[model samples]
Target: MPNEMNKKQQEIKEKMQQQKYQSKVDNVTPTPPLLKNICWAFVVGGLICTLGQLFTDYFLGLDLPKKEASACATAVLVFLGAFFTGIGVYDDLGKRAGAGSIVPITGFANSIVAPAMEFKREGYVFGVGAKMFVIAGPVLVYGMVTAFIIGLIYWIRQ
Candidate 1:
C-alpha cells in the first residue's frame, strides 16, 4: 500500500512540474513580425538580382555573348557571397535579410564556405572537407535530380 501511494505521489508531482514548464513556455514570446521579415527579404533579394543584371549588362557592353555575360555575372555574385561570408559579413546580412539573402546564388556560396570555416578547427580533411558539404549536399543532390528529370522529360518530348 505504501509503494502504491508513493508512486501516485510521484506521478502527480511530475504532472504538476510539466504543467509549470508548459505555462512558462506559453508565456514566452513568439518570433518577429512576419510581414516585416517578408518585406525585407523581398527587397534584399530584388537588389541582388538587380546587381547581377547590372553586371551582365556591363559585360554585354564589352561585347561578350549574352550567355557568357550572364555566366560571368553569376560567378561574380558567388564570389561576393563567399568573400563576405569569409569576412563574417554575410551572416549579419543573413540574420537581417533572412530569406532575402538566402534565395540568391550568393546564398549557395555562403552555405558552402560557412561550414568549411566553422569546421576548420577540426582539421582540414575531417573538419573542413567532410562538413563543408553538409548544407549543400542535399541541395546539390536535389538540384541535380530535378535537372536530370527535367532533361529526361524534354528528351522524351523531342
Candidate 2:
C-alpha cells in the first residue's frame, strides 16, 4: 500500500547518499614515491650548473671575453654530454640518480643521441645516422613552429 511505497523510496535515497559519501572519501590521491625523488634532481642539476660556472671562470681567467667564456662553457658541457652518452655511462648514471641525471645539458644531449646510438647498432649508415635525430627533430620542429607563431602575433600587435 502507500506505506510500503514510502519505505522503498527512503531505502533508495539512503543507499545513494552512502555511496556518494564513500566515493568522496576515496577520491583523495596518495603521492607517488617517484615524486619524492624530485629533490635529488634539483641537487644534481645544481652541481651541473656549478661545473658550467667553473668552466666559465677558467675561460675568463685566460682573458676570454665574457661572451666567449659563456660559449666555451656551453660547448664543454655539450661535449661532455655527447661523449658520456656515446660510452653509455650517462644512462647508467640516470638509473642510479633518477631525475638527478636528467636536469642538465648533458641530459639533453643524452635524450637526443641515445636513440640514434640504438639505431646505429642496428646498422650505422642504413639505420642509425638516418634516425640519429628522430627524437629531437620533432621537438625542434614544434619549438620552431610555436616560436614563429608567437613572433608573428607579437609583430602584428606592435
Give the winner by lDDT. Answer: 1
Give the Å shift of residue 154 in candidate 1. Answer: 0.9
Clashes of each: 0, 0
The estimated TM-scores of all candidates read 0.81, 0.67
Each prediction's Cα lDDT score?
A: 0.97, 0.83
Kindly give the stretch of ten consecutive residues in candidate 2 with the minimal lDDT sum.
29-38
RMSD over all Cα atoms, model 2: 7.7
Q: What is the per-residue lDDT of model 1 for residues 30-118, given as tens digits with 9 covering 90 to 100?
A: 86889999999999999999999999999999999999999999999999999999999999999989999998999999999999999
Best by TM-score: 1
**Candidate 1 pairs with clashing backbones:** none
Query: What is the per-residue lDDT of model 2 for residues 98-133, given as tens digits with 9 covering 90 to 100?
Result: 767766777777877888778877798767767877
